[model samples]
Target: MKTTFISTQAVSSATRLSIMKMQAELAKNSKELGSGRWADVGLELGNKTGRTVSLRQDFARLDSIKDTNGLVMSRLDGSQAALEGMLKMAQDFSASLIGVRTGDTGADVIQDDAKNNLQALIASLNTSIDGEYLFAGIDTDVRPVTDYYATPVVPGTGPKAAVDDAFLTAFGMAQNDPAVINITPAAMDAFLNGAFAAMFDPAAWTDPTTGWSSASDQNVRSRISTSELVDTSANANEAAFRKIAMAYTMVTEFASSNLSEGAYQTVIDKAAEIVGEAISSTTVVMARLGTAQERVKNANDRMDVQMKILNTHINDLELVDPYEAQTRVTALETQLDMAYALTARAQQLSLLNYL
Candidate 1:
């Protein structure tokens, strides 16, 4: 025991190592207190690392779904507004046609109104959001309708073109020809209920390249939730839109007081029937859209609740107790201050101090 003595260098090295260790711990405690999160999450939750990681991933997924749902809600809202506008316009046009008095002047004015409404209806059908056409089905990049006024309505392609072709093919006369007055009710009815009607048929709609089946009505769909998918878009080729197109095509292109009473009455009667059918079809579409919107909203609400719970779980896994961390930080600071004072004092002392 008398022969054993620790060297000065050894004492200094031991003191420096201890001070460095305390400083490292103090820095960690300070970080935990300042950031409100654990400084060493893996060390704190060693066995629960897998569970915490999974929870954080789930929380991230929920956030992404919420952002996507917001966009979907906006699109659905816009579609509802456009559909309602088209419905109101259809209803008004139908009402106007019921008691219309046909004179040269009145007929011309009616034609002008019909043309305007047809263009309006087309504009509504081509509604888009963020450069995505809402009525273009899976083909969102392509516009659903060509501009009625700008482009020539190609035969066998578009609504107006088909109507124009049908008028010529059925009566063997151009639209608004005086000879149309000689056409019988049976003939007019056959044409209206046959090929002219077929032109608007959803069953006949097809694209050569995409081959989007008309049987599905060409509505674009989106997966709104993990398990539920919804048709986010409306089909412009639906019965309601077609009926409005047909009526508008007739009044705008075929209205005439020069025709006999029978031919003029035929236009009025056919249009009224189609318009009535349109109102019914529109009501059904509205109901369907309303149901879809409700589904989207409900999913959003559920996800919101899930996100809050997930965030709490994630915090429990990664966050520090502020009071506990603050207490540790204070204690570490006091220890570090003492260690520095001792180290400084130790460095100033030497073996030849008491000569």
Candidate 2:
């Protein structure tokens, strides 16, 4: 080939162009090494980094929901435990009446025994968790058991009456605001003189201290519940309580504390059945609670799965791939070194040097 010596200016220009191209390539490779992506994202999540961050945020939110579900389930489980204990107590009471007789128990003794159980039932109704009463109707702040006495009344409170002739009302019987007082239904009845009605009477409640007197204390909700607890003439827990109470009463009446085998058997059988009812009630509650627990667990499991998937997606979008990144880094380092050397050489270039 003919001698083709380029002018110094031309060589310098060519070197400058080459250096610029090399720098652009080096930047491209270095980016890939640092970010693990082949290219930059425009506006959309066209790149993995943006997508990964979104996935990570979603994962964290789902985990929080799962934790809340678990807490509710735990509270349900604790309530189940309390119910189980109540069942055992019911069973023991009935079992004592197998072959017992009324005469064997004292007249007053039967009433007293039932009263004690009623009190215990009241106690159970007052059960709470995390400071909230379980059976306080809509008012969870108050205890369920207020008293064993009578209904409360504001003085001179009359029956609800119509205000006009069109309304066919004579007078309005309105209770005072905050009318609810903590007195037993038995006692409240005496205050209101409402004790004569047999519905409010627990035949087994006859103690002079616990009698139908004005001294009773009870919550409004608890008072209302007393009617349900008392055995009605239609269907009564009275016989059940009465039978057991009588058995104990007889022990006092008779010199013998040992009940006859026949009597004991009868009492035991009744007691057993009552216990079964109590157990069934408790079991149903527990089963419902368990269902809630299951839901919580399922939520947690779902959250866990979701979080993992989100994490993986997030990783795909944001994580640097070590293998690709390292390769790019190596190439970039070489280009950077070459660029520095070329720049230095170009600066030193001269006509004499070429000669």
Candidate 3:
């Protein structure tokens, strides 16, 4: 028959091309397995690896967020501690006043104790973490109290017998009214010591001459409940009244023995009442601090949750799948072997069979 012989070369070439295409596909899927996502090569025919990659990245982010939660919790813990200290100190002072003997010795002893407690209290207010003051109200950059001099309690060094005005400044509050002590600390000390001239000492506290206006420093931190933030020119209101209400009671009650039941006797009771209110207000302050601590903890938890979701996503996107990769490798190896054997067999073929 007059017919052209078709070459085995053509058949083998077509088979090789088909095998190569399948091989390429297998390799791509294998990569996606190891990478935990499809690696789209932009070949017009295939690519679906985007989702896995995105999820894997998310997983990584979640892990980072979880780490941050620990730090946030630690900070909240510290803040809670500071607030508790303030409450405890205030409580003890109140209890002492409530149980005051109203005698000179009793008042004097109580005043001495108060002075020590106030020093400790101011130290607590200046508590800091990472060099940031916690009780500085809004002015955390500075210490809530200062050692302006070796003896801040000394007259002329600053206000006498008063919470260090420097402490007020550190918290960024203004006390332009320099007459805070009403009597120099030295003279007040002499009076407390029972010196006869203490009554006439210019430095000594005279209830009549001493200013009682809420504007005076005697009531500066009155509003100093936990939530009370003292600011520059912050009006002395119920807040400042709350802060020194206890101090007012101690001062007046001790002086009560000196003053007979007269016009100012009622004033002493009023001062005592004010101090009692301050103690009540301190309880409210503790509650507010507790709230702040809770809020900070909550915020940290939310961040942690978000991070977890991200971590899972990142893992899915980035990691390799051993089973799928192994399957692809095996399948591709088999196809390669089959194609090589077919090519070898084709090369040996010729027209010998036909002859």
Candidate 4:
């Protein structure tokens, strides 16, 4: 019989190596038990790890879109509220014009109300959230409308100065000139339809030297979902906004009380027509925004369902059974304790102890 001699040092080294391996497994199982997830997702899932990776990416994308849709909805709600307010102002101004069609309401009262409404309209267009103007279209950093009543810091660079220049260019005189009484309905209508209308054009209104609005013609667009992109902002350069400005300017700047009866009637008639168009256009814009809001909401609903399905799939691939993990952890701990006790006993086994 051949006897195999193994040194005590070799026996102790082998026991220690086995104990270290069991300790490592114990640590891994302990973590899995606590977290209820696989300790090594890539190791456990192997080639199918790519599927979880793709699903997780899709889940993250849907979460990002859902977050962005919240902001888009906020902007749309703000825009709708502002447009509704503008529509109300147009309705009230139109009613005021009708009240004065019989020449019963004082011109001064109408002029005062028009000036206030114009200022309010500009303020509304310049509405902002976190320093971003809602009606600035894609030019969110810029204010959409300039204050028409603001005194020009420069000689000919203010919104009021631009109006004055247009008025002078059209009529050969200032707005307050006493000779305005001699202005005929034909000449006033021509001026209103021509030079005055041109002032609110997107190109002219964005002119650096003399402009009423700095808003972009292109509105802000947002992706509400993986497939849906929608416009999320309004622009001050919309014809509805321009017409409201024109109607308000006609009453405020035309020296309404000084005009001949026929010319005053023409101004009122033109303002009434413009106000009606503004109201109709605003209603259309509101309806479009409402539609966008509904689409965004639906997109979120669909994304939520997709995310839930994705999470379930991911959990199946990446999560561990906590009860099984805990049982393995308990077994490994018992093995480690026994292995440590044996390793210690093996180290203690020396011939000198028997001596």
Which predicted model would earn the best TM-score?
A: 4
Assess the local accuracy of residue 86 in candidate 3 as a C-alpha lDDT between 0 and 100.
54
Q: For residues 290-350, could you state the per-residue lDDT of candidate 1 as single tens digits?
A: 8888998898888889889988988888998899988898887888888788878888888
Scored by CA lDDT, what does every candidate get? Answer: 0.76, 0.44, 0.48, 0.87
* Model 3: lDDT of residue 317: 48
- State candidate 2's TM-score: 0.43
Q: Which portions of model 2 show Cα errors greater than 4 Å? A: 1-50, 97-116, 136-142, 147-279, 321-355
lDDT for model 3, please.
0.48
Instruction: Report the C-alpha displacement of residue 37, candidate 4, in angstroms.
Output: 2.0
Per-residue accuracy of model 2 over 1-355 as CA lDDT, tens digit each? 6988776577677777877786787777677676666555433256555565666677776766656455455445555555555556555554433323334453234335445665565455566768865544345565534344223254222111100111121112112212222223333224222222221245413223322212112211211111122110111122222232223322222212233434323333433454455545555545654555565566566667777888877666655667866876677678668767776777787878768
Give Cα distance to truth, residue 34, candidate 1, Å.
3.0
Q: Comparing 1 and 4 by lDDT, which wins?
A: 4
CA error at residue 1 for candidate 4, angstroms = 8.1
Candidate 3 TM-score versus the reference: 0.49
Q: Model 1 off-target regions past 4 Å?
A: 1-16, 153-159, 176-181, 184-186, 203-218, 346-355
lDDT of 2 at 34: 69
lDDT of 1 at 259: 62
Ranking by TM-score: 4, 1, 3, 2
Candidate 4 per-residue C-alpha lDDT over 54-126 given as tens digits, one digit per residue, 9 for 90 to 100: 9999999999999989888888888988998899989999998888864635577888989999989998999
